[model samples]
Target: MRKIQLGTTDTMITDYCLGTMTWGNQTPEADAHRQMDMALAAGINIVDTAEMYPVNPVRAETVGNTETILGNWNRANPARRGDYILATKITGKNAAFVRMGEDITAASFTAALDASLARLGTEYIDIYQMHWPNRGSYHFRQNWGYDPSAQVKSVTLAHMEEILDAADRMIKAGKMRYFALSNDTVWGVAQWMRLSEERGLPRVISLQNEYSLLCRLYDTDFAELAVNEQLTLLAYSPLAAGLLTGKYQNGAIPEGSRMAGNGDLGGRKSPRVFDAVAAYLDLAQKHGIDPVHMALAFTVQRPFPVSTIFGATTSAQLTRILDGLDVTLSGDILDEIDAIHRAHPLPY
Candidate 1:
C-alpha cells in the first residue's frame, strides 16, 4: 500500500482505509478480528469505525458494540496499536439512541470524545470526526429534502467555533490528534477552515463524505475546495452500497446483503440505479476488469487527494476487492466511463 500525507499533519494513512460498519451485527466478532488481521497484513493501516456502528439497523442495543470489538483487537494486539491509524466518529443529531438525540455542542463534543476513548480502550484518537453536522447535511441521499434557507449563519458559525474550541482542548489534553467532518458541505468545511485559521485553533484534516462513480456530488464543489485547502477526502461507500458489484441486479437481493437488511440502501435503490450500475458493470466486463476494482480505483485515481474507505461483511468479499488492487483504468475505459456518466448522470 502507498502512504499519503494526511492533510498538513505528519500522520500518513494508506491509500485505502478498512471500514468496520458491520462488525457486531452481520459480521461476527471472530470474523471481524480476522478481517482486521487480514487488512493489516495487506498493509491497510487506517481503520474507520464509529460509536453507532454495526449499523445495518442502528439498533439501540447494538450501539457501541463495534468499538468494543475494535477495542478487543487492540487489547489483544497491544504491541500493534501503532500499526494502524484509527478514525472514529461521534453520532450527530436525530440519533435519539445516541446522547438522547443531542446536537453537537461543546459539552456534547467533550462527552462524546470521552465516551469514544473509553469504548475504544484508548487514550488517544488519531482522527475524531463528527458523524454529521448539527445543522443537518444534504448527503446520505437526502438531497431531495435540502433547504439551506432553514439554517442561520450565526448559529452555524457559533457551533463551529465552539466545537473547534472543544477540539483544541482535547488536542491539548492528548485525547485526540485531529478533527474531521463527515457528510458535510463545502460551505461547512470552508467555515471550519476559516474559523480555525482566525482563532489559531486545531484545524480539520479530512472530510469523510460519500464519493463514488454513482455519486459524483463531490467531483465539482468538493473537488475545488479539497485541492485549494488540502482537505483529504476519505471516500466512503465507493461501491455505491454494493450496486457496482452487480449483486443486487435483476431485482434479486442476496440473503445477507446490506439492501436485504436496510432495503433501499438509504435511498440508493431507485429504479435508475440498476440502469447506471448495469452500464458500469458492462464496461468492467468488456475490459476484463472487476467491478469492485474499477469502482474503487476510479476514486483513487481522481485528480485530487482521496482514500477510499471500503467495508466487507465477509472475508471472501474482502479478498475479492483486495485481489484486484493492481487494476487501473485505461484512458479508453475512463473515456467510456465518462460517456456513461454523461448518459446516465444523476441516475439515482
Candidate 2:
C-alpha cells in the first residue's frame, strides 16, 4: 500500500503491481475486472501487462487478448481510467507470430506503440517497456546455456540508439509517459543509460525482471545497478512461478493450476526446486507466516527498492495475495532467510 517515486519520473506508483499475463487465458474478463477493482481498492495503483500475454501457452490467438481485456475494463469504467498506472510491454525479437517477429526498429516501435494504444483504448500508457533486449538475455533459466560471444557491441549500440530515438518521439507524441526494460543485463542497461544521456533520449525508469526466493540473480550486479542508477525493480514471478506458495510441494499439483497446464512451469520442475521450496515453506512455518505472503514480502523488502508483480489465475488466489499485502517480515525472519539462501543457492 506504500507509494514510491517511479525512478526519476514525477509519477508515483504502489509497491505492488497487479500482473495480467493470465487474464484471457486462465482467467475470464469478469474475474479480471474484479481483480482490478480489488487491487485499486487495496491501494495498488499499478497494472502490468504486455502485447504478448496470457502466456502459459502463449498461443497466437491469445497473444494480445490480455490487453483487450484491460481495454474493455477501461472502457467500462471510464471514470477510473486514470485511477491506476497502466504499464505494458512490446514483445521483442523472437515472437515471430507478433508482426513476423520483426526486431524493434524505428518504424516497428512507432507501429507497435500505435497498435498497443488502440488495443488498450487509452490515450497514453503510464509505463511502456521493451519486453526483452534484441541482443537476448540470460533470464528465464537461460543463464546456464547463455552465450554472449555472438553479440557485437557496435551493432547493439546502434540498435539501442535507434530505438531510444523512436521512444523519445513516442513520448513527445504522448503515447507513453515512461520507458523501461525487462530481462536485460547490466551491460545492456549501461548502454541504454549512456546513450540516453548523450542523445537526450528517454531514460529508463525501471527494470522488470524475474525475482523471487527461488531466483536471486537480481541480488548480484543488477542490485548494484539498481541502487546506484536509481532504477527501481518491478520484480515479476515473485512467487517463483507459484512454487513458493507451497502448493507444488510433494507432487501435489492442483487441477487448473499453472503446472497443470504447463507441466514443468517452464523448466522449473527439477529435483532441486522442490527441495528449495520445502526449505522456504518450513522457514515460513517456523515463523508462523503464510508462505505466499512470506515470499512476496521478502521481495519488496530487498536492499534495493522493489515493486513486486504478482499474477493470479483465480480470484481466490488474488484475494489470498492481497490479504497479505500488509505482512512484513521481521529482522529475525530476514536473517534466517539469508541463511537459507546461503545453504540453497540457485536450487532451480
Candidate 3:
C-alpha cells in the first residue's frame, strides 16, 4: 500500500482506505476489529466510517455502532492510534434518526462532531465529512431524475459559511484535523473553497464520492476540480458494489452476499450492468488478472490523486481486496479498459 500526500495537508495516507460501513450490520464487532487489524498490517493507513453506518439495513438501533466498534479498537490499541488516519461522516437530510433530520447548521455541526468523537472515543478525527449536500445531490443512482432548481444560492452560501465557521472552531479546538465533503457537486465544492479562502475556515481536503469503471461520474468536471484544487478523491465502491468481482456473474448471487440482501445492489442490477460486468470480467480473464484487482487498480490510475475506499462484510472479501492492492495495470490493459468504457458507458 503506497502512501500519498493528503491534499495540501502534511499528513500522508494510504492509497487504499478501509471502509467500515458493514461493521455493525453484516459484520460482527470481532470480525470488524480483525479486518481493521488486517488492513493496518497490510499498510492501509486510512479507516473511514460514518455516524449512520452498517447500511445493509441501517436500522436506528445500529446507527453509531460502527464508530463505536472502531472506538473500542482504538481504546484497546491506544499506542497504535496514530498509525492510521480515521475519517467519518455526519449524516445529511432524510436521516430523521440523526438530530431530527436537521440540515447541517452551526449547532447541528458542533453537536454532530461531538457525538462522532464520543462514539469513536477519539479526541479528534483526521477527516470529518458532510455525508451529502443538504440541498440534495445527483448521486445514488438519482442522476437521471436529479434536480437542484429549488435550491437558493444565497441560502446555500450562508449555510456554507455557518458550517465552515463551526468547522474552523472544531479545528482550532483540536476536534478535527480536516473537513471534507461527500455526494457533492462541483458548484458545492467551489463554494466551500471560496468561502474557506475568504472566511479563514477549514478548506476541504477531500471528497468521498462513488467512482468506478461502472461509474464515471467523477471523471470529467470533478476530476478537473480535484486536480486543480489539490483535493483528494476518496473514491468509494470502486468495485461497483461487487459487480466487478464477478461473484454475481451468470445470475449467481452467493448467499450472504450484498446482492442477496439488496437485490438491486443499490440500483446497479440492471441488464446493462450485467453486460458491462461481463465485458470487464472477460477483459480480466484475457489479461490473466483477477477482475477485482483490475477494477481496483483502474481506480487508482485515474487522472487525479485518489484513495479508493473499499469495504467487506467478511474477512475473505477483505483478503481478496488486499491481495489486489499491489496489482498495477499496464498501458495495454488501460487502453483496453478505456475501450470497454466507451462501449458500455454508464450501463446502470
Residue 63 shift from truth in candidate 3, angstroms? 0.4
**lDDT tens readout by residue for model 1, 1-348:** 777889878888888999999999999999999999999999899999999998999999999999999999898888998999999999999899988998889998999889888888888999999999999989987798798888999999998999999999999999999999999999999999999999999998999999899999999989999888889999999999899999999999999999999989989899898999999999999999889999998988888889899999999899998887667889899899999999998777
Q: Which residue pairs collide, candidate 1?
A: none
What's the CA RMSD for each of the models? 0.8, 0.8, 0.8
Model 3, 1-348: lDDT tens digits are: 688889889999888999999998899999999998999999999999999998887788889999999999999998888999999999999899888888888888889899999989889999999999899999999998998999999999999999998999999999999999999999999999999999778999999999999999999999899999999999999989899988998999999888898989999889898889999999999999999889999999888989999999989889988998999999999999999999999998
Give TM-scores for every candidate, taking all chains together and pairing residue i with residue i: 0.99, 0.99, 0.98
Worst 10 residues of 2 by lDDT: 1-10
Query: In candidate 3, what residue range of length 10 has the lowest lDDT sum?
Result: 54-63
Question: Over 4 Å off in model 2, which ranges?
Answer: none
Residue 305 displacement in candidate 2 (angstroms): 2.0
The Cα error of candidate 2 at residue 68, in Å, is 0.2
RMSD of 3: 0.8
C-alpha local distance difference test of each model: 0.92, 0.91, 0.92
Model 1 worst lDDT window (10 residues): 321-330
Choose 2 or 3, whichever is better by lDDT.
3
